[model samples]
Target: MKTAISIPDDLFVTAENTAKKLGIPRSQLFAKALEEFIQNHSKEKITEKLNEVYSNDTTKKDNSLSDVSVAILRNSLKNESW
Candidate 1:
């Protein structure tokens, strides 16, 4: 895919220098950087969205745990051979 992006002059200079140091083309460097940036920030964006939704919920809710289920969980925790 071919696309156009405008980066600041200083950042472009740094990117070009880094690309030369890594022995790769500027386009490859930008693509790799974009891939990493998306991978890192997408997870962060998902977490932020989840936090926003959960924090905005004002209702105190009941969890559906039965007494037998709680006892089984406690027994499992007490037993070393889980």
Candidate 2:
């Protein structure tokens, strides 16, 4: 697929330089960048949906662990450095 879009000259020059440095065509660079951008926003959308669902649910109980469980977890992690 072919498309045309306008961007700032400085941005265009930087992208061109980056493409050359990476030994890929300008189209490939733009395509890869756009693909990553779309994927990242897709993840963000999923996170937003999950947050909305959890926020609207009033029946959700506290997720705190029992004292014994917390003690076990803390003991397990004690061997590891922060």
Candidate 3:
């Protein structure tokens, strides 16, 4: 597929330089950049969903759980040098 878009001359030059330096065709550079941009954007969406899932107070840690965890950590680390 072919598509056309416009960008500033300086940015275009930079992209061309980067593609040449990396030994890839301009199309491959653009495609790789777009793929990374899309992946990062999708990660943001996944993080938002996780935040929503953990937003409730019921998802928060309580004192008993913390106490148990601290006791276990202390027991495991007592014989080890700090």
The sequence of per-residue lDDT tens digits that candidate 1 reaches over residues 34-77 is 99999999999999999998887454342334656788888888
Clashing pairs in 2: none
Model 2 misplaced regions, further than 4 Å? 60-82
Which prediction has the highest lDDT against the true structure?
3
Q: What is candidate 3's TM-score against the reference?
A: 0.69
- Candidate 3 accuracy as lDDT: 0.91
Using lDDT, rank the candidates from best to worst.
3, 2, 1
Off by over 4 Å in 1: 49-82
Pairs in clash, predicted candidate 3: none
lDDT of each: 0.88, 0.91, 0.91
- TM-score for all models, in order of appearance: 0.60, 0.68, 0.69
Model 3 C-alpha lDDT per residue in residues 31-56, reported as the tens digit of each score = 99999999999999999999997886
Model 2 misses residue 68 by how many Å?
Answer: 27
Q: What is the lDDT, from 0 to 100, of the residue 66 in candidate 2?
A: 62
